[model samples]
Target chain A: MSEHNDTFFIGWSNDISAGLRRFLMRAAAFVVVGLCVVSALLALSITDPARSLFGANAAPDIPLDVTLRGVLSSEPYPFLLTVGDAARPAGHGVLLSGDGKHAAVIDRAALGGQVVEVKGLLLKRGALDMLVLSESPRVLQNIQPAAPAAPVPMGRWRVVGEICDGKCGAGIMSPGTGIAHKACASLCLIGGVPPVLVLTHPLEGRQFLMIADSQGRALDRGVLRFVGMRVAMEGEVERRGDVVLIKVDTGKLRRL
Target chain B: MSSYKAVTWNRNKLIYDAVAIAAVVLYIQVYRHFGAMAGRDGIAPDDATLSMKAFGSCAFVLLSGILSIGPLARLDRRFLPLLYNRRHLGVLTCTVAAGHVASVLSWYFAYSDLPPLRALLVADTSVAQLAGFAFVILGVGAFVILLVLAATSHDFWLAFLGPRVWKAIHMAVYGAYALVFGHIAFGALQDARSPALAIMCALSAATLVVLHLLAGRKGAVEDGQFAPTAATTPWVVACDIGEIREGRGFVVKLPDGEPVAIFRHEGRLSAVSNLCAHQNGPLGEGRLVDGCITCPWHGFQYRLEDGCSPPPFTERISTYRLMLDGGRVLLDPRPNPPGTRVSAVVIPQAHQTPVNETSAP
Candidate 1:
């Protein structure tokens, strides 16, 4: 009787061990499969719309076409239009001609510091504004050669800003001005995307300013290296109708 | 399994390939549709950029799946089917990645004043920036490695390069994976505001680590339990003769964690390394086909007596000395040089004893 009892206990223990091993194997398989399923689902679930991910600030819904009399400064690549009183230090934005279909060719240097009447679409984001010119700006009046309006009191100030291509920076690409975007920004700038200086702080109702050389000329290829970097530059700050122009000395541009 | 020509198309493999392709297409289409729908309000990206993002993200997801299949199969034999035709998966991953590269080049770099390739190289040389240009270089490096692996995934290339060289080349996949991780981390993720992507990457990495650790631990434990008790002697008790059936093998792990496969055939036993010389497939999992030990992976064969592939094929695997003590089988832990001829240990009972019916332990 005692021998039978010992055999029964042994058999029972063996069965228990086999059951436990089977359970563990099943559990392991379950865990592995579960992890794979969950991971795949997670990957699928996290994919945001490309627009939201890449194009954060898109074009405005309602396009406004208006004519404004402003001062035009051509130091930067794409000319800037300072609306209202140029001496008041406010309301400046990018001056672009023609519709989105074709690139407009306007010799900005020939029309620097002249009060002009421009007709274009008014694109605004926050305090930053871009006036897409439908036609050539008609010079309403020129700064008198004698008085010169004291050169609008050009103040030499140091400011930090990222240099990015204007078209994408305005509404095309979200967070477009960064190291990751440096290469794309360079490409766009080279392809004539109007290099725009995005200021770290809002200056007189403008966060973006067109960048150019000290003599109010379009920047050369030397600025390509500083495309996506936040750099400090001592530049003469001038505003014309929601557009700010920074005449940066190429030699003084220091990467911050 | 030893056919010398192209891959034989079968129903199961055909179905698997079709399903995989369809799944990828469906995933991309669905994501694009939903993504576009979600972006109806004020943030609609242009179709070109949208398509690029769709293809790029699709390829990334496919790559993640391709990487996960290996560890998943190790954890569960049910996942083994995924491993059997993994070369197809790799090729598909390369194709998808190529699509992504195409879209990026065309949309972003094509119209640039510089040539596309030159643009990619010289556009952003900012090494000190937060999203430095190095990420693009890393991406290119990973893509190149993937391209090589995909191009050489055929059996012809496997035979030409030999298994050892082929395996070393394939191992570069891990390096590519590391580069890709850096590419995404520093590139797209730099501006990513959502936590979902970050969490998914972390989970995938953790899953791979855990699976590999568990698989390694299981092998280590098995080796530890049956390691030779006497360290001074080279001989270790492998198992009883009854543990291996005729024309089959019983795998035993040596003290150093090398698995040796002991095969029983015609009242004789021989031992060889469990790792196949080609692709490192488990020889023990394969059967004796035409008296040669066939590898389960690619049907690479070696003679049981000398651990050498037949002439015209010079691949060799290390063999061990086996001794039968009464009914118990003992294996010498020390391996004979590759291709060295070693005599088999003959059982004493010979033809008088019937083969055991019990399965291998």
Candidate 2:
């Protein structure tokens, strides 16, 4: 009986040894797998693209329609222009006519006071146009020289109304143009929030719409909340159909 | 005299068990790192899927290795020492499989670029990704079985469930193994280009087949050793009054070549199949505990008097009719319906022969 018991003990020991061997082999396999995975991850990190993923805030270079409100001086021969400021530097303006680049630019002092419209090619060099006057510039927008000479009292007029046409309803309010809707759509699509749009339109009363970009950026800049506020304005006015263009010099806009 | 008890414990197996578990955890960490790297490369979805495949395949390899260790030991007793950590290997395999499932789901939801709610719903749906769904289900089932087995591994559960019930429920590990194996064969091997994976699969299948064949051969060998009747043409007396030792069983055979195991406990004898139902492990070479026989291969137990398992497990084994002759034991080869109780026979210790010799000189 003792011999039998001794044999059983030996068998049990053998079984235990087998178990240990299996355990060691399994452990080794796991270590190999782990190391391989780590190496792959490191490789991926070392080879990623950097510049295009980060530097997206630079302003676009291609020309787009820009309208700013400012005071115009009636200068030599009823030239409609704004008072020169350092920020708005003077530049050589090329008049776009039937002949192309043939028109000349008048000096800023010559067109400082007269409330009139002068449309040509807008060249970016300094504050105002700084050259001798040449041919007559075609007026495509705003008040013409023969239209209205009576200054309608240079105090302050609250903006009674504003209407956004074309793609302007996208929530990107840029003073007096029409390209706000695309930006608003991008914000809505990405961030899942809408920017509040407040604008006083002449025909449709004051309206407020939550604007969102298609990518969902939303009202991150926080500049659209004062759309209905009263602001003092001093600029030569021009009306093309129902859209009024106010090229103003400066104004104190206080929220109502 | 210390009873000359032959119960030797292998301490080295415990160390090996710890090492295997640590290795599996380490592999999982590596797999996760790879997944992260893949994601950063703008290939998160592919990385996740590949990682899951790797995990499942790794688990299958480990499990097959663990299961095969027992049969390898028979080829050399020196290898028997490795068997101690087999259960740990199994548990570790299940854990790795669980991690693979989690990683796959996370990647599916994260990189599919769907809305969170939509991702969750789509993950549950079995469209366009049948492999993922099947893998998840298999992994979940294996995890549940592992949890139960791990919880009940203590001696307390052995004493609480009285061995028979515990062994029966634990047999589900094999079922889990089968499911996971199918999941990998159908899913992972599809995209594998490595000859290593193909070799591993072939080796796993061959090892399983060889191990089962050895177990069946061991059963036959035990039966042959206890011939019981050389003169009787059809009937044979399997055990003797003194041969059915306490805490142990003996495989006996009749002239018809039918095999049965006679278990002895508290001076009583009852018979069951020599083949364990769980993995076809030889029951005659196993230990008798709490009035049941425990298969030495994986510790599955069955009641001797009646084949029914304890509560919460409904598996049963074939029982044989035992008759008491003049100081000898006779067994009918044909098995009675499972769960039917048979009369017990008192077996004396004088005629019993020891199965193995002591290691101590």
Candidate 3:
């Protein structure tokens, strides 16, 4: 606490000793550069790419309106299975959502198996694709003996994965899933945006599945607590077109 | 400290503020542009998320620097300039923290079914669970602490609230810092991939701890040295007159542990409480300014003879009677009433030769 030196610093005084001034300038510069380095390091380290929806220019807010022709299914959730065109051989099984975190409202029984035209804003992350409905869809063509939007049942088994809201999982927020996005994911799931079980490891070329209850309806809200956490669930995995649907037994879900 | 009604933005204060603001801007820009790397999956983060990271990290770094200043100043006299106008840095830190909150609300909770504030409060209600507890609560708590401290940072609050009360409240900054540390450790640390954050936080925290220990040890040693020899007598021989540096206060602690600083300025010796009236800073380390013992901590000046802040500044400190008993400075352990005028003891003619005249009065 003692400095036996000639320099006396009076803060209010305008004049500063040349030696002290030099020391302060150098110190300030050093601190500033040091902070920049810290901030840069923290920013780089914390925001993970796997969690971000739009990582590496994957997608920005969809600019052009998107309309897809597909067969609608209503049992588990309102989703469209688009038929492929010349430019694209592999069609998409994109979940349909409504404005602001809610799932798209479409009469399941009426549209089931019927070919229809769906239009909405598209939100896409890796594997998960969602088309948010701008308006109610219309039947483009209803052919007799409609193509059954069949889901091939792939026998019951135990699976481990993190449950996340499909919309965010697809890429709404930069990082749309994980512990940080737990509350948001819960909100979206509550709002009826379909939940998905993102497998900890890709099982049989499948990374995720649209999650449903054992009866094959939208998932229970009680499971929201487990969202963004690693959890194990016993469920019947069904390969539905390009996507997989897991009919999980809510009773068997447990944190891992 | 002058009349604090209109904050005197001195050249140093202005320059300090400018540099701080510039640093903040530089840190944020660096974070936005260079910090984010394109992982194989997506686009740049949204403004809201980017803002959160930018402001949050910037606030953290600023807080670390702010907390480091006190101990750094003690460990080395050269670092004292950083201590000057440090409140401005604190205010800026609070401002940046608020920006983090604003960005969070705009993005994370804005789209939720629940109201933004409600979502913020009840969003992640895993308070019962240790693994996923409500870390946002810690962040909010720290923000509140920072807000209170920042709002009352002005000298007006220091005067109105009284230094003791004001200082007590400001000391809560350590608690706020702890809360912030917890907020990051639990919140970001849980989700991050790289160990950079954990490492940086550990280093910053360790640095602060080490600095405080070093400074505290130094002060303890200094305090132990000035212990009075006479327990029976009211008067204790403080030190040799030659030992008291010219234009500086030399501290002598009484038997009761109360310290009195004996100052030698212009061949005359006077004594006052070693504690500065403002913030209880170590006035003993300070030198005489315009014949007033200026507190090294904040430049608060008290007249040598009468411990009153020279007219127009009403602050005062307790003065002590000094005597030149055969060149060995004798101190009356009992203190004179604050502002009591005690005549300065003139040094013997043989010891009156001035030291350096380079420093201003």
The TM-score between candidate 1 and the true structure equals 0.73
TM-score of chain A of each: 0.58, 0.21, 0.83
Candidate with the greatest TM-score versus the true structure: 3
Among all candidates shown, the one with the greatest lDDT? 3
Best-to-worst order by TM-score is: 3, 1, 2
Q: State the TM-score for model 2.
A: 0.41
Stretches of candidate 3 off by over 4 Å are A1-6, A43-64, A83-92, A105-115, A139-151, A249-256, B1-4, B36-43, B224-226, B229-233, B240-242, B323-330, B346-361
Q: Candidate 2's error at A99, in angstroms?
A: 53
Looking at candidate 1 chain A, the ten consecutive residues that score lowest on lDDT are A3-12
For lDDT, candidate 1 versus 3, the one ahead is 3
Local accuracy by lDDT, each model: 0.65, 0.45, 0.79
Candidate 2: tens digits of C-alpha lDDT, residues A35-55: 355434322332111111112
Instruction: Identify the candidate with maximal DockQ.
Output: 3
Alpha-carbon deviation at B9 in model 3, angstroms:
0.7
TM-score, every prediction: 0.73, 0.41, 0.89
| Candidate 3 lDDT over residue span B1-361, tens digit each | 6536767788889999999999999998988876466543434566677789889878887888899999988888878878888899999999999999998888877775788888788766766677656778889899999999999999889878888899999999998899999888867777777788889889889999999999999877555356455443667889888777787777778878887888887789998998888778888888777777888777888988899998788888898877767768888878888999999999999877655545423
Q: How far is each candidate from the true structure, as Cα RMSD in Å?
A: 8.7, 20.5, 3.8
Q: What is the TM-score of chain A in candidate 3?
A: 0.83
Docking class of 3: acceptable
Off by over 4 Å in 1: A1-73, A80-93, A96-162, A172-180, A199-204, A213-236, A247-256, B1-4, B38-41, B128-133, B221-248, B252-259, B265-268, B285-321, B327-361
**lDDT of model 3 at position B193:** 70
